[model samples]
Target: MDGTSQSQPQPPEQTPTSLSPSAQLDLAITLALHNWPVLSLAVQSSWGGPTSADKRDWLCAAIAELFTDRPDTDAGDLEEVLLQVMNDEFDVVVDDESAGDVADRIIDLKGKIDKGDLEMVNKLWEDWKQREGKASSVGLFKRVETNDEDQETDEDEEEDGEDEDVEMEDAPATRPPREVIEPEVDEDGFTKVVGRRKR
Candidate 1:
């Protein structure tokens, strides 16, 4: 056998978690720049063209995770860089979906960051993260609108009850046990039916 030195396979790269925050950001941005162009391609082995959802999801997840380390880093500016890379380099227009929303927020954040108004950004991030955390804890598909609508309806009922109480003072307190009276507002901005009883 001839003694020929074989080339050794390179080791896998280190993850950003092992690096400093700034370095982590730099690494993420570098990787994003490199990988973004292929983001739309190979989603489903498109003989026609790359899919938008795959690319959008990839970029959004990358940017979101990239900024997870928030201290002493201009996350907004970094996000702006991501947007610029996608738009300027990739020439992709992202106007709708979570990625677009994230991009819009990043644009807003860039302005605040430039003005040194970090408190607003932090507050917004906190609120957004809180909502995202709660959404994650529950099944994301679960409808939270039910709870919100119920709460709003409860408030409306309470307000209506107050008005009813004022009107009921002159009337008898006891009514038919199965019958209920309520106010119904019409499209004309008027309560057309007041104290209408169910048959």
Candidate 2:
């Protein structure tokens, strides 16, 4: 053997379980780097992160927390999807037959709008709009009409104000001359508290 060449040192072995939380997170992000903006950070200005995985994990959790039906939404599901995307080399892969399955889960109205036959494409403005009605926010924050109790309370407060406005502006003064109750006496000669009275 010639023994002319020297070998270079290699990166330390990185088994999946041996990965720290941060390293696992790094692997997750590296896996998804080519896709759309990591939405977790852009979703809210208040969001900041130690790594991409935190944002990704939070993003999936937030989506599930906000809208549970879209995907299974468990972190494990997100992990599986993300890793699947990575294994597929970041090509867009839609598990459901159509985009509507995804739209239905996350965008409540969009799912409702999807065609039943799967052959028909839905029109965004015509069919979907009438179904949504006057709900500008599309049921995210519904405009609930005042309930009976709230209506009654509001009416009482308004009437109370109107009555006060029509009557004497100042409340009548009362005498503050009343005395409190006498203290209790004990056999040991120490005064004990019986009860309190208002002056």
Give candidate 2 regions above 4 Å deviation: 1-3, 22-199
Give, for candidate 1, the lowest lDDT window spanning 10 residues: 137-146
Alpha-carbon RMSD to native, per candidate: 25.8, 29.3
**Model 2 reaches what TM-score against the true structure?**
0.19
Residue-level lDDT for 32 in candidate 2 = 27
TM-score of 1: 0.24
| Cα lDDT of model 1 by residue, 1-199, tens digit | 5899888986443232333333323333322332333433423333113443434434443453445435344545554655554554344444444344444555455455545455544454344336556444232212222323433564587676655344223221222334455767888889865653332
List TM-score per model, in order.
0.24, 0.19
lDDT of every model, 2 decimals: 0.41, 0.34
